[model samples]
Target chain A: MMGLHKKDLNLLLIVMVLALFAPFILNPFPTDSALAQFNAGYPDLMQRFVIFGIFAVGFNILFGLTGYLSFGHAAFLGIGSYSCVWMFKLLSYNVVPGILLSVVMAGIFSVAIGFISLRRSGIYFSILTLAFAQMSFAIAYSVLSNPAFNLTNGETGLQVYASDPQWLQSASAPNAPHLFGLPMRATETLTVGGWDFQFNVGYYMCAIIMILAFYLSIRIFRSPFGLMLRAVKSNQQRMIYTGLNTKPYTLAAFIISGMYAGLAGGLLSAMDPLAGAERMQWTASGEVVLMTILGGAGTLIGPVLGAGFIKYFENIFSKINDNILHQWFSALPDGLEDFLITIVHPFIGKGWHLTLGLMFMMVVIFLPGGLVEGGQRIGAMFKRKPKDTNGGLSAPATPAE
Target chain B: MGILEVKNVNKRFGGLQALGDVNLDIQENTVHAIIGPNGAGKSTLLNCLIGKLEPDTGSVTFDGQPVLGLKPHQINQLGISRVFQTPEIFSDLSVLENVLIPCFAKRDGSFRMNAIGTVGNETDVMSTAEKMLDDVNMLDKKDVLSGALSRGDKRRLEMAMCLVQEPKLLLLDEPTAGMARADTNNTIELLKEIKASRDITMVIIEHDMHVVFSLAQRITVLAQGRPLVEDTPEKIKGHPKVKEAYLGETAA
Candidate 1:
């Protein structure tokens, strides 16, 4: 079981099965049906789900384990994306070198940022990270994209120009980002009945990488280092008094999560060879925080769940406009149809954030441990029924529901 | 030479002289007690020894090496472990994990990545932690969250955490500060059993004469941040200076 405990192994297997069959699972609605717009089987959105899943999984290492809330993790992601695009521009369209370079570059920056930011814990640490991320966004937007040194390519974003020297690219090789001869954009469409399922090379790659990242996260959660990180969160005073240094432990978690974000950013560019200054924005960092918290910050599967939840809403919910709303409520009476659309309009389309906000609030209030806790509670409820059935059979005097 | 030596230790917090020219020696394999009333600077002295506070003037050495200016973790690595008046276990973690952390710290020095392998696979550390928990009679509750444990159990778990490291010096700050009689006796018995089984030095700071007299071999009475007397517990019980400072009664 790859050195995993039985419980963790089962969890990993479940994730793997779900990821491998996502195209089918996500596209339950037929293409010709009105609900087809809700199907998230497309390559672009599917790739984002796993990529952000990787980012949140990594963020959980630092924020969840060590209880250090970082508000600047997106800086590393931007650095990763930029490094990836630079590779595509100089080294070839092959994603291997770009992804590897992105991880390394993110690790370096994380070390520098983590070393400074980790000096202060709690809100101070968060503010410091926020400051660093904002600075990076500003620099990437204007400073680095200047004519003299266009590292990030400024507001227009960094992309591979045809005129740029791609030293390792061969004439026969795919012009787009690829692994060997397989282009990332390559996809096979499978039509069964009215459903259209997309099996994209890029999505599969991201999924495989996400699975690996998840496995690594599971290992870290069960490792001595992960225990130490949890100890850092629970009682840093106790940790220090017990002869454990908190500095290197927190810094290591920070660097590790940074590398994960970097890999995610690299994947983002690999899917579409563009690195934008907005990739490093504070809002991007905030989104990962939301994903981790919404999924269950400390749990192994929580971040992935949170990532999928947010990404699904962002993609599907936002795609529903007045036309779609009108189409869905067309069966109702004319007055009621317009009324229903009016009520739903504020929660969809450009107002998708309103829906996400309401859900996030509900999750925070009712399920403090996030979706994982909600699932566990439901599971416990089902388990309680069997035991209660035996007791209920014998207890004739007791009131039965 | 004693295992720990404090010479002319003076610590000032702003205008207040918290510890004024304090000096003492703690020998190996013996329980030493520091007894004083409130504001007698017992906690401050313990903080100084453990590197939580810097003394303005003094040389505190453990095993002939100066511990001044070292961080708490560094001092801990030098074989000194402190048990707080309130147990400081990792509350969010399991009881077993609470004990296992100290074992890792003892083996891995200050920091090691140790990220690839599973904690369950560290059979040696796992066994050591289990044995320590067994020593504290908490083996069955290993899976229980440390936060959910009763206060007495929390203290025992904290003891196990410190003892798993097998430090040269174990400092207890009011080990039975607010315990009921039954819990206090249990702690006393636990400490007695630990003392009988291990070759370790203990320094206890307490206001409770019952716990102090039950465990301490040597007693040092402090008054107004100065060491008034150091003697065997039997003699310390009869010392007139101890009667005056500790008993709150004027002794002629």
Candidate 2:
């Protein structure tokens, strides 16, 4: 285990290889089948997996490493999306401008929020972020409402037209310009025997950016700054007494996380060509928090795994209905079929959230380390010898214990 | 000139007066110990000097500059470091990583936004951190999680962290407060070794008279919120006021 954690160089290599080949493994299901909803190989969903993965990864830098939980990260994401759309309207439809603006705007916003929020730590910090998020949501809904649509288009959201100028138009020459000139064309199609794969070019773009974000995050996690962050998390008073300033380090982390959220938001608008104030809602921010917690807080791969897990289950579970349940029950015995349907009905359709809530609760209660620990436990069980099984590998070795 | 001078510092918290007209001057390259009973405001005074708390009155100066209202890091940049009574350390970080933080702060000042450079590649910072860890005899446990260390080792790591900054003045609150008898002796020896090698001035707040006598060149005793006496360690040990304030009827 020491060797495994000591050399994180191999960890990124493994993740990169897996991400590169994920499309092939994920594309195995039939397009019309229920399993297809679980297929993250599709361009739209794949883009989401990577982009949201970036968002959660950034958030983990602040929440996971430093133990400072912010509930308003989605506001940064919304700022990114809106800025991207605005770029699409004023300048080129290229994603570069949008991404740049998103980062700048999010950084500015975070500085203001961090200055105030950082005055209080722990639960107060969390509350401050939540309050800020809610305030932004309300302002986006009211001031940017339709009657005076100066900022956002209110509930209608901001949309880009195909007639937008092509600054970096070469990227989208054959294809129509996406928000800020990002090419939305389906660029590649692979055929293997009787199977065909249609790849959206935008997904690859998102993937490349995600890889860059991952690299930067890895560097930050290993830096002296990262050590100070962990120090602040463990004991702020000790850090101060050590003659070190923790405020600036934490504020930097907060801003960096905000920029990641902005980038994710920019990508979202680029893919869909629309930005809504609803994206900045506290609930949306809470979703990423859930993703980070459910996956594993501090580990690198944990956030991505958590993002994919929540997105996949959300896509698959919400689509199921009473009719779908009845069809499955029809294959069973008459009496048992009705009973199974009754028991499973609430967990499908609109009740999908109930299932997710229960899963979140169970994970938090039983596996506080999240899915990362869950995977480790399974690996330990298989590797344990019969005689050593009673002591289980998960049990920490220590003098005090 | 004295490295640190506190002139008539007074601190009040609601109805309580933590420090009442406290005054002290610490010369360069000497150990000054503050011995007091509980609630004598030693910790409060330390906090005030380090900028964790601001005294209602009086001023603090370090290296001939006033340091009354500066932030802790600002005071640190002016060459003062502190070690808390509790063994405060980054539990999740490796022992070496904890030490490297102060080295980075001292080298780069308060902030350096070099997001791309790997922390391990900073050879100077790493070497300095390693040297400090070696000084504290924690070089062997460099890769271990700091939280896993024994109490004595944790205190040693914190000292190494402070030392890496090369501060002119060091403030230690209860350096041997919770240590075993053997650990307490080890700490005193470590302090002596540090003093022999550097021109560092120290202010130690301790309860153990043996540790105090072994390390302090000068000792100041406090009762209530005021300083009762200040003298050489030998005289302090024999002072009737100090004995009466601390040893009670048993010493008589």
Best by TM-score: 1
Q: Per-model TM-score of chain A alone?
A: 0.95, 0.89
Q: For candidate 1, lDDT tens digit of each residue in A1-401?
A: 79997889988998998899999999999999978898999999999999999999999999988999999999999999999999999989999999999999999999999999999999999999999999999999998877888788898899999899999999999999999989999999999999999999999999999999999999898899999999999999999999989999999999999999999999999999999999999999999999999999898899999999999999989999999888888999999999999999999999999999999999999999899889878887888544543322222210000
Model 2 chain A: weakest 10-residue lDDT segment is A392-401
Residues A1-401 of candidate 2 have per-residue lDDT tens digits of 21123446566666676566557766876666655545557777777888888899899989977899999999999999998888877766666787789889988999999889998999999999999988988887777665545678788888866765645555544444353343675557687764446677787777777877877777777666776777788887767666667888899999999999989998888787789989999889999999999998987777877887888777778888888877767879978988998999999878888889999999999988889879878877899645643223222321100
Prediction 1 TM-score vs. true: 0.96
The TM-scores of all predictions, comma-separated, are 0.96, 0.91
Question: For residues B126-182, could you state the per-residue lDDT of candidate 1 as single tens digits?
Answer: 999999998888887787778878899999999999999999999999999999999
Candidate 2 CAPRI classification by DockQ? acceptable
The ten-residue window of minimal lDDT in model 2 chain B covers: B111-120
**Over 4 Å off in model 1, which ranges?**
A385-401, B247-252
* Residue B150 in candidate 2, Cα distance off native in Å: 1.3
Instruction: State model 2's lDDT.
Output: 0.81
